[model samples]
Target: MMKRFKTAAALMTAGAMVLSMAACGSSSKPAETAQTTEAAASSAAETGKAEATEAKKEDGAKFKIGVLQLVQHPALDKANEGFVKALDDAGLSYEIDQQNASGDQSACQTIASGLVANQNDLILAIATPAAQAVAGQTSDIPILVTAVTDPEDAGLVEDNKKPGTNVSGTSDLTPVKEQIDLLRRVLPEAKTVGVMYSSAESNSVLQAALAKEACEANGLTYLDVTVSNSNEISDVVNSLVGKVDAIYCPTDNMIAAGMATVSMVANENRIPVICGEEGMVDAGGLATYGIDYYQLGYMTGKQAVEILRDGKNVSEMPIGYLDQEKCALKVNEETAKSLGLDPAAVK
Candidate 1:
């Protein structure tokens, strides 16, 4: 195999020397021609060996990856974990720098700037805001996002099918209609639902709109309550207590961070909360037909591998989505019993 890559110059020179020796007379200086051909082959072999060693070193170089997480909630945390695990599982050499914004937009900006300045080979943004923050910094570096509902809606990309920029990854868009149906299955008589989320989250707003359309299609009245921050979650849940039969919370980072408060308030009123993801359900919401964040992140990590390892262009990479088969019903049995509903019956 290595001989095949021998230099054209050496091969041509060796051929020319043999032809010259044959023309001069078969027995004239045969040993000299043979020595000349052998020297050319040895030179070519050395060149090939050097080139192969250089390529091997380049292939073994460690990649620098930066992680910019929007917040430290379970969904985002799982997503972060999944992304790292994928790289490890692929047996790729990498040096990852993980940074959390602590749910602060300002912090997101700061961290994103630092990640870009560090000149990482790739950057993984865990949510919409973090994606936006990192994308705002550079157009050349590949960025993979997870736990984001709609990349185009968030202005991180021009199209979902073709990102047309240095941004692309898996979408955490859960089944809104199915989640609403889950609520209906659990509370057949429920006529109204309070759709709650953080006003600052673009992903939440997109899901909220889908939830509204689903609610109308199901013949249920929908009320929307928006909070600017996590501190207002308890108050917002309180405001929905008398106004709606149930509360529907999307996979909003802010809202998920305060799920315990939302649960404490909504469960007290015997109003079940249908969430957009499993983590929220575990945090005390009643149920959800939601996508797995870890799986979503793992999917995103695969995209990163394609970009970093396989040299796939991020701009041409279509946005990835988790199929419905990966989504399932998650119900908190304790919360169900507390709400006077059978845990198994809700299913």
Candidate 2:
């Protein structure tokens, strides 16, 4: 009986030992599964962090540009288009706030004040008056001027080689001699050249002076028919009809705005007009020998990019000219026909 009792006890002890070993093995497996789940969750969290970092990099890469154009004329419009294209080429997104002054100097000043208040990254001034307004409003903001005849005359810059101020941009002034030569080429018999421009416009005055010098060199007589405002355009144009053989239109914003009226009167009197910009040619002027306004805007856009992205000083950057290769002769067939002039004769 004693031996049987001892055997039963030993059997109970072995069974308990086996059960304990099985419980420990099962607990070990659950602990390993828990560790694996924690590791996967940690890896997923790290991946999320990396994606968020990349998204931030993408979100931080953009810029802002503000454009102040004098009017909606073709030359200034083309320059604005060129500026947009330049920004697009650089893969930078920009917010452009464009304002047209409708040929009002006070309106330009008001718009420029608002832009400066907004703290725009850069300002693009399309004409002489517009550039002057922006420069007067803010010295901290860089101003890029286009379609402006002479920055110096406009008082936007000290010199072309060294801007010496916060303003710099492309000049629309092509060689004055080339323009005079073009006039003579198109109208070989025209001895007396009549010029109508806004006397208030400094750019117009500078162009008039240059045109006068050019005409003198070519043995062509020049007559000044200056007008101070839009109201005087018709009178100025009518006054020059019989006295002058041909009319020369400078890149005066006021004159450009009133081109349709000027064209109607000039064409009625059988006078052919040679303008400084392609827009005037399109507006009923006979022809133009000038730089592409859009190309000038694009050139200015590049300078703006440098000032914004490359940390370059605007005062240090020399004013740049648009590539002259972009300059060309644009003639109007309808105007030529109406004036009894041949288009092919001008080129």
Candidate 3:
């Protein structure tokens, strides 16, 4: 995809260069042909000059973009990459200042302030915390948020369909009921599941509630385990070792970052960990029927281009969502093996 974008940009540039060179070559033609070539050369030169001017105008309109990410986890990182790739592919001229809060609220506030001070043309917030921080700093700046569970629940937007504000983007809200069902299919004998996430993250709290409802509907009992930060991850997961048959982890930033720790303890106890997204499965989870963060980010990036290049109103832009077809089964075969489960069977 990147190669395609670069090639398209190169072709646009090459067209102007070729036309200019043609006009110059025509100028050096013989006197006999000069009479004929003169008219042609003059026309060619004018067209070439016009095209060059237009190209220069496009190149000169460089947008200033700021990216505020909540942490350094793979899911958020992939979303960030996808967003940037969209800008590059669109051939939009822009400069970006990317900042990560490293899962700290104070750091998020500080970074948000700097971005607002810099007065960026657009801001891409990778998670709920980053979105809230940036949104609090300015209501005028066009903000695009990705990897968030429920934009309405997070208080980032007035409504998901019509943001009615300067904030709008993609949601990483995976199919919670389907995921819970996946856990049941993977562990037929499992009766109790541990729903784990960081209590401080509102998105996680929302997902935890959904997981609980899903569990009840699926005729399974659930145990709620909350941690405030990464340091408490291992201990919390360890506490669930013998208490639950399996674990359901949400797309929480802190828990995503500490997935390895969670998997280490859970797998050691022969407990399967079903995650909310592919990155968590890759990190160490047994499986997940979840959305792709890269695609979600790319979806958001397309929205960025619509606002920055097309001059579309940010407030009226509806929240973007990946279709159910975009969700796929992702499994860590090694983790599945360790838990004495067949990866093929889960799929």
Candidate 4:
């Protein structure tokens, strides 16, 4: 009986040892599982934080704009100023990368290509050739043109009402027909009108054609004196000084640049001169019936605001014209007097 008791006691002790070992193994398994879960949670949290940081950086990014000007002139300078001011008023910050082509078409293309390669958000082309260069570079990037006489004639778009492409802006065109009438009103006895322009300028070509037609309608004779560069302006003006009753100067950039020379010659010869813009009149022209450049620039700024803030597509926005409030008839008193005329009569 004693031997049997001893064997039973031994069996009980073995059973207790087995239960203790099993409990230890179970506790160790739970610790290992907790460590694995913690590692996975830490990895997920780090990935989420990285994604949030990337999103914030994207939201805070500023827009970049590229400005390409054909040449630096007073009229174009005003337009550029207006554009920058309008963007500033909209409360949107931007970086303006301005480039001048120096009146070279190839230089314009190069500037445009560089702007495109940098991925500018928008492009403001200041003239016809600059606009054409941008259009040739990209169809996806939005382009806005200023100081362009006829967008259709420049081939920037098919129509002014509906650009039908990724291009639209303000036209610097004034009423050529009305300007002709004003010349007649100011100088009734003047029978022949001489038009001087740069032959290479598309705007000049278009304006000269319109002037010819208007002169024909008014029973006035028209003469065209074309100069290929600034060097020839003086000779051209001298050539036409005595031939015509009065000289008409359009908003030709080359002619506008050399206004002092043209004015000095015209003023000396006692030949009256009519111009297409106010700046020219201020320079030495007898009178001009056209839009105010500052006002036009301001108008262009407002259009840019619509494009940037209102999320309006540039292609859908028709080219805008300055209101009559922006148009005026300005005359140079000194120039009129030199021609033995009265400014009060036209005013």
Candidate 5:
């Protein structure tokens, strides 16, 4: 597979060297010849290619995307994968410069500032904080956010229906009410549900509020437990161990990353956790009405194409949401059984 690349690279280098030699040895054969013209043509073609390549190097493609991700976690990673996959499917040429904030808001600010300075053709911000950081920096550059629960609440857009700014993209707003109801169906006799999320993420805070409301609407008591970061996750989970009959985790990045600990504590207490997304369910939450992050990102990528290729204004583009079909009912049989609930009945 790499053989052609090596051959082509060698030919390009050779053409450049021959062009240089011809210039130095021009006096020896001052008159133009067919052979000299051919060499000159080949050299000129190579030079043009070199210039094009340099432009590609500087911008990646005529279309460049600077991606700012809030953290290195499974759900966000999948969203980024889907965003790239959509761009690939569209057959559009693009360059992606991805930066991970490693769960640090300060890192997100620095990365967002650099991306704005680079003057990329577009910006892909994953998660709420990442989107907020980029939106805070520049108003001129087009920014598209993925995996955000509420873009308007995060202040990334003026309206969910119409952005009215250079910010728009997919929202991974999982069905909180449906998830809470599913928890009820799984554990009917259950009384209290602990809602866990990161206090720092506006998305999580918003989702937690929605989840709490849903719990109240569905005749279930809700307990709110929040952590500022992963370091506080285990202790938080432990504190909720015997206090709640079940746990309902929101579409939160920090909670999603530390779900293993949450699950460990939940399982030990025989509490089934109903998560906001599928990755959390897979991470050991009993079940969820979850959205596929990849599909969310893929849809966002298509939106990006409209802006880059069709000159659509981000300000006019409405924020996108995953269809209900994109969100599915997923239950972990093993977790269900361990909690003494019949898997089918849990469904």
Candidate 6:
């Protein structure tokens, strides 16, 4: 069945969104949803009903958007919430088909293709993997991404200016050097930092390189550890426990989802874990010099409205950045105390 938002249509407005959604859990829905919806939509589009459905949008119907999130985690979830709140505040009535890939690459492919099959006006892909999956399925559909660290490095665009395709959105590339500086200030005696992330995510790889550079500049040894998926997080983190002074994780989706696992193992060994975003800090990270994901998502939501309502070309939209990066130190008081750091003074 087709999911439609039936309401009076008005131009989507660009507004500041304050509501941040709760962290998400992976969707247990079958991966066939995309295939099933695609087949159904193909049949409808063939029978002229699809055009009729689109005509409804011209007659006071809601705008439809399909959101494909890579996994259930705080950063991604906050971004999703901000996007929805942006739409609501713009007074543009809309319906969103939100799907989570459960940190599975194949699941991302299935969800992205399905959203394309359903023929949503625009597709919102959170995370690099989600964006890549949808971009692979169609270059014609406008895809707006958020929580992605580096779009150009991930091969999502030609460059920030003039994406050269039907894709563009916000980049959550916080300053790695500042995050490392935060670690040095807090753990002044630490000599080696362990950097962990998903091996498969290009964004994580990019951030990890910057992290290594930051560590070098601080005269700290960099220990690298990576995993292909969440199943390896605890064991991998455990292996690196005594060998490093601290752990640094970028905005890697896999690590973000299993951060509690990373935190549990690392904290048990009394090592401080520094993260790339506030959501990670909230999860179990000792601290982070990170960005507010809610604001990032709101920015992506504004891009969505611009493409759908203002008739702007997404390919030329110029990859968006926080006009002023909202990066700052956020510490988990409990985690800090566990590591013997003065939580209040650290802040």
Superposed model 5: Cα runs more than 4 Å off? 1-61
Model 4 scores a TM of 0.79
RMSD of each: 15.8, 21.5, 21.4, 18.0, 18.6, 20.2
Candidate 5, run of 10 with poorest lDDT: 49-58
Pairs in steric clash, model 2: none
Q: lDDT: which is higher, 4 or 5?
A: 5
**What residue pairs clash in candidate 1, if any at all?**
none
Q: Is candidate 1 or candidate 6 better by lDDT?
A: 1
Candidate 6: segments with Cα more than 4 A from true spot: 1-58
Residue pairs in clash, model 6? 34-114
Poorest lDDT segment (10 consecutive residues) of candidate 3: 48-57
How many collisions per candidate?
Answer: 0, 0, 0, 0, 0, 1
For residues 1-347, write the lDDT of model 5, one tens digit per residue. 69999999999999999999988798556555767988899889657644554565456566778999998778899999999998899877887899999988999999999999997878999999999999999987889999998899888888999989889998888888888888887788889988888888888888899999989998989888889878888888888877899889988998888888889888888988999888888888899888888888899999988877666778899988878765788888998888888888877
lDDT of 1 by residue, 16-77 (tens): 99999888876657888999999999889657634543454477977788999998888999
Of 1 and 2, the candidate ahead on TM-score is: 1
Tell me each candidate's TM-score: 0.83, 0.81, 0.83, 0.79, 0.81, 0.83
Residue range 234-338, candidate 4, lDDT tens digits? 888888767999888888877877788888888889878888888788888888888766666667767766765455678888987776545789899988888
Q: Against the unseen true structure, what C-alpha lDDT does each candidate score?
A: 0.88, 0.84, 0.89, 0.82, 0.87, 0.85
Q: What TM-score would candidate 3 get against the native?
A: 0.83
- Scored by Cα lDDT, where does model 3 land? 0.89
**Top-lDDT structure, candidate number:** 3
What is the per-residue lDDT of model 6 for residues 183-299, given as tens digits with 9 covering 90 to 100?
Answer: 999889999999998889999999999999999999999988999868888889889977998999999999999988989999999988999988888888999977888988998
Whichever of 3 and 4 has more TM-score, that candidate is 3
Q: How far is candidate 1 from the true structure (C-alpha RMSD, Å)?
A: 15.8
Candidate that beats the other on lDDT, 3 or 6, i.e. the better one: 3
